[model samples]
Target chain A: MQSFALYPFAPPGDVAALRADLRAWLAEHQPHDDVVKRANCWASFDPDFSRALGAAGYVGMTLPAIYGGGDRHPLERYVVIEELLAAGAPVGAHWIADRQTGPLILRYGSEEQRERYLPGIAKGELYACIGLSEPGAGSDLAAVRTSARETAEGWRINGQKIWTTGAHFSHIMLALVRTEGGSERNAGLSQLLIDLDTPGITIRPIIDMAGNHDFNEVFFDDALVPHGALVGTRGQGWKQVTAELGLERSGPERYLSSHALLIALIDAAGADPEPAIAGLIGKLTAEMWTLRQLSMSTAAKLAAGEDPMVEASVVKELGNAFEQDMPRRVRAIVDCAWDDDADLARLLRALLIASPSFSLRGGTREVIRGIIARGLGLR
Target chain B: MSDARDMLCDTARAVLRGADDIAPVEEVGFALLLVAEGQGGVGGDWGDANAVLHIAGMLAPDIPVADVILSGLGDVSMPHRAAATVSLMAGAMGQALALSIDHVNTRQQFGRPLGKFQAVQQSLAVMACEVAAVDAAAAAMAARLDASGFDADAAVFEIAAAKLRANRAVGVVTSIAHQVHGAIGFTEEYDLRRVTIPLMRWRGEHGNDARWAQALGRQVASFGGRGLWENLTARAG
Candidate 1:
């Protein structure tokens, strides 16, 4: 059994200055949108905001400067994103590209691919979405049946991807597709960076119960991209995608998605709140503080070039539970209605609806727990 | 961990193991662990104290190891006690997790080890997460205390948050540890209760969930919504 140790989260350079600069930038540039938009701010798409943020050099802080990046440290990027999330900045547009795609492209993409995509990603004009979850493969991602067959022109893709967030607006998609005829499970899968505007690709909106079109069902009907689109190595999509998820799961967004609600709760409850409200605030704050510690440690571990797979899973599991339970717990303690128009009430209702997807997205609670169990030397 | 702290923990584990009382613990000179080297003491910091107390928490939960170590300070405040209790609870929770993992891996049900079952794995995973959270809380609290030179007032937010988080984890850690262990875990000879019982007691010691929650909540409320974030980031980085 591996005991959890706190990795030293010492970012290089001036982190306080980095935070102050970002906060100041957000104050001037961040939209004063509806408070509900700030609750799950990462999913709130504001292309102009993302472009301005990218122009300000916060988007691709870790990429090399030649690719229009800041050449900053990974922890510096971590500080920037956390500050963005905590302040509920709308960062959905360039989020995927900046967080994973840019790094992945820089690491594995060919020089041509990097030259083509990295600058746009850094500029926040181009967007990307992951194509992992298929209809038959949600938690069981190894069961992905989306096929990409090699041909004279390129790799022709034919499959359907459900629950693809931002597919409609994303310029490209880094998709996992089965490349071998008979290979099964996690083997023989290859990742292809496909242009979303290909002739055969069609993206249809999947309106969620919240009446939000944040997700879509994307159909790749013989969508062909050039051979240079293959990222890293063939038959290594499983490994690459797993690494990408580690980047996805342990981020500040996992916990700070519902930060707007907490802020509203605190502002609504005056300095001297009722005991029950105060107790609830304390409980939430403690969990949030502890979560931040765990998350930063995991980030530091990642920055130190170690695979913190289990630690990342631990953060995702606990963070999902915390964010999901906040609305229900608040509703139980505070007097709020489903139809209330106050910020707290509106934020509460929106999050209560959004909370169900918290664990379902990224990875389900059971899947994350299984990963932790595997790390525990069990199964 | 530094070599000196590793040696301190090694000494703590060796001296405190199987000892029924605090005599062996005191004999190890743990009382002077936090004292200055100029004063003929170890001159160890709170990080060292946290590490040693973690070992003592695993090896001798019934002993007053925290008291012995804090005796170097002459007077210990409630927040300091709370910080020490968080470390102890972290160690105990870790032990409970280890014991449960061992039991499930060995105890067979149907045709395989209990750990092979999805249900059992999920339960243990939850327990592991809670243990990790408490461990993280304790470690972060220790860092804050060391940063503030052991002034509990300066590190009150971390102490309160850590203690409250540890308190919140007791039920989850204890219940899952026993649930995965089956009937054998209930026996006095079984090692699970050695840590679980201490964790339960420590949850109410120093400060319970309500006490720390109200303190931390009111303190954060005073910081206001946005100020809380500013204050937290400023305190750490």
Candidate 2:
């Protein structure tokens, strides 16, 4: 088997200056709130921060200028994303819209759809949630049974989408629904950009173990959306969603989500750490640095218009492992109590509880490994 | 990769294949790979060295290809040696992964290839991820070294991070490769050991995990938490 080569992550135009501007902006605007908020900061909902960030042109960066976007390169967007994630900025409000939905709409949505959503998304006011998982379609996404029937008025969507993150707050959902009758598995699926406020939709909170309501159970009972809501070709949702996932999985978020903990661990360790702490820090840093390289290369490949499905899966697998193991590894060598109130202890405790979903979300560990196996030419 | 690097890799692979020592590699004048063109040498960059060493690593694990390549620079530091070893380790780990994949796909178990088993596929998948990580690390480190003009001290952070990451991957790559290969991989005749044994050695050679980790950890601590991210982004792109 051939080994993976690092795709050159060359974002045109002064990247250092881009980073500097974002860093300076983040310094002025990012809320210095609870330390725990900084540790899974993407899930932290702060519309004001997201809007300010959008106003500053950090959101919807890769979209066309006609759509109120900055018309930046994808790698430029990648740099902005990595900076936002690393700083533990509260990016939840505009994360999905900017990351995937905006691009998906640009690439696959009709002109009217783009005209309706892109401006708001670029403005950071329109949030979107993915509707892929159902009660029966967690890992086997092809098992999705959410149906959207065609009508003269519009498409009527009827289904229950479980674990829909941001559905409670999102303005729209780019859902994968069965548009063809008797369609089974992956075929006959189509994407519909449903307005969340459509008459028959219901979004109820599904509180996580951390008592966080970042995700929800969104049920649609004949939720009527405009006929123009369909994204891309009919019966092509499977392919489109798969492509959207490429955007979802390999960004800096995969590894940088738990960056707050690393920062906490480092600050706690101080300049002169004991051998154990020092060793752990070193190992973690090495892994993080290596992961950044992999993630960036994958982003570069994506920017070059290549589908790095396997490469993206590799990043998610390794990045998930690193994020999950950090809390446990720190707990092993540190003398902090689980109930302690120190920033390190609290961050560790929060991450220990939240780590289980790190591998589960985006894609489960098994599914990601299977993707890697397929890339390896294994059945 | 540039045409020049591709041609260099071609020559390295041809000379190093099935060789018993570094003599053929020496005769091929690989020692001049990193020397300045004005100084009567090839004037190649670290990326060229990485590509060649990667080939040498796969073809001649027992050979001191890295040593000969470094000898071109007259005197090299520990970080430089560590950087070279990372590329070599990447090549060998990649070979181990390729051999393991080939074995599982061909070796039958319960009336089918072992690779047909989910257990085996998952194990190999994990091994592949580690191999991919090392390969990416080695390549990135090479880029950093090239950007820094082969100054070991200047590229110390990349060297420490890449070498340590590669060293840590040795366990996963070697164990999983042998695990998936079954008893046949344990034999000296198998091609797996040709790379695995060298990987195990290289993990501890220029700098062990603890040594590099401590050094890197100390450096990062000095950078502080925020400063670490700043320095990392600034140092590269």
Candidate 3:
């Protein structure tokens, strides 16, 4: 948990080299399909590409060496993730474990857990999913009714986890469950690592409004696990969960989602741009700069082992709002009628379909604003 | 990173903020821009000197003789337009920056400094960047005042951009200042009252930044992908 330095953040040095390399790699792996399938450039579960990336030593990039990680810079991993996302790499296979789960396990897991789990993650041999939100609880996280009870052998897990992305393909679900009951909420909560392949554990795909199978309705009916499956102390889940959420909340991926569309819109808008277009680009560009600073600052803080939960949420909430607004503004400003099946336009349409869940998935705007206000001591 | 301008600006700041003889401050801030050696102004490119303009505006918001002089700004070519008003706007911005900092530094929130809040700090950072960039851009444009001066319309765009970012920065900064000062910032007798009122007037006095950016973007993009960034970089470097 040692802190890292905030280096100069402009064009030059390793940063520039990394940018060039990433761009070249992206060009080679451009999704060849005629129609944009999932707007997630890395939409397909391509084990070959995953292993290729892992072989190239790009996986588990932020973890320490002892756990088989490449032990590179987290900021470097950030650049990598952003490059992949921007290039539309079908990174779904290795995304979850690489992003937060691997980092989480690296930080808080037991030696056995780290040795067993980290290597596979590094090679993209294993995929992981976060199982936090349940159907009933929504943003009221402490109200999660998923329960785990101690047994002679180990622990018995029950209840459901909804909107669990990649659970069908993932090997494990890092679940937040109630290990024990208390008079108040958040009393006996704990995080448990549940094997998705374990008997009685079911992952049913939840087709979203976009008609995509990225999400799942996971059910755990007496899923059995060893006592060692617990991520941390029983009641420490609240604290642990908050930290995990922070990782999920902060990153360039939170923004830059519709970057390709922005490029397309700019190209489509034709040569002599209207003043409105110029002004819009200028304003968005300004917001983009400010938000990038805010996000990277929070990440630097995190690398330094500081809990930037409030700041992370602020960045995510605002960044996503900007991202989600991008498509609408692009459509409004660029008047060409796009077929729902065209390349970039189709992708734009698909994103429009999925846009509602963008904010709701991470954390609702109200929840985030409340946190921002709390951070400011206004509420 | 530039040092001399900062030093000059530091001194200008002291005179404007610390020793304010009202009308004279405006006169001196405006006088510094008058190129000392050349026929026109050279202090325009010097950020530190531009700060003196801000000093003048804050010292005497009602009688902005400098503002009146720049108001004589008309009929410059497109490229030179940015520099012309910029050469003129430099002082007004100096006034705004000084006023913003003075107003916000004393402004309090939660019974402590208002600058303590992350939100407020973010706004201040933006204000600082706006003030600095406007100062530098004006300084750079002014250097070419005699040769390769921007066209008349460029002044409108340059002034628009400067005024837009500044206006937006001030709106944010002023709100925070008032919030920190609580009811005091809004009070007519408070030091911030004059500064805050003039912030709006100066912003509107010239073309807004948003209007200018849009106008420039329309011109540049429509004019065959013209990249004016290099122009900025050469001067900034």
Evaluate model 2 with DockQ and give the value.
Answer: 0.86
Query: Which lDDT tens digits does candidate 2 get at residues A200-240?
Result: 99999999999989899998988899888889999999999
Query: Proportion of native contacts found in each model?
Result: 0.79, 0.83, 0.16
Better of 2 and 3 by TM-score: 2
Q: Per-residue CA lDDT of candidate 3, range A1-379, in tens? A: 0011122223223755675676676567545643354354444577777877887777898777887798787777776776666555667788889888998887778888898899999998789998889988788888889989999999899899998888888998898899985524777888888788889888788788877788889998998999999986777888888888888888777776555555454454457666677776555544444455456666766776778776676677767777788777766765555665555577678767767877787788667755654453343
lDDT of 2 by residue, B15-67 (tens): 99899987898999999999999999999999999998888778798999999
Could you give the candidate ranking by lDDT, starting with the highest?
1, 2, 3
Candidate 1 per-residue C-alpha lDDT over A261-326 given as tens digits, one digit per residue, 9 for 90 to 100: 999999999899999999999999999999999999999999998888899999999999999999
Query: Model 2 chain A — which ten-residue stretch has the worst lDDT?
Result: A1-10
Off by over 4 Å in 3: A1-13, A33-47, A338-344, B1-212, B215-237
Cα lDDT tens digits for candidate 1, B19-60:
898887888799999998999998999999999888878878
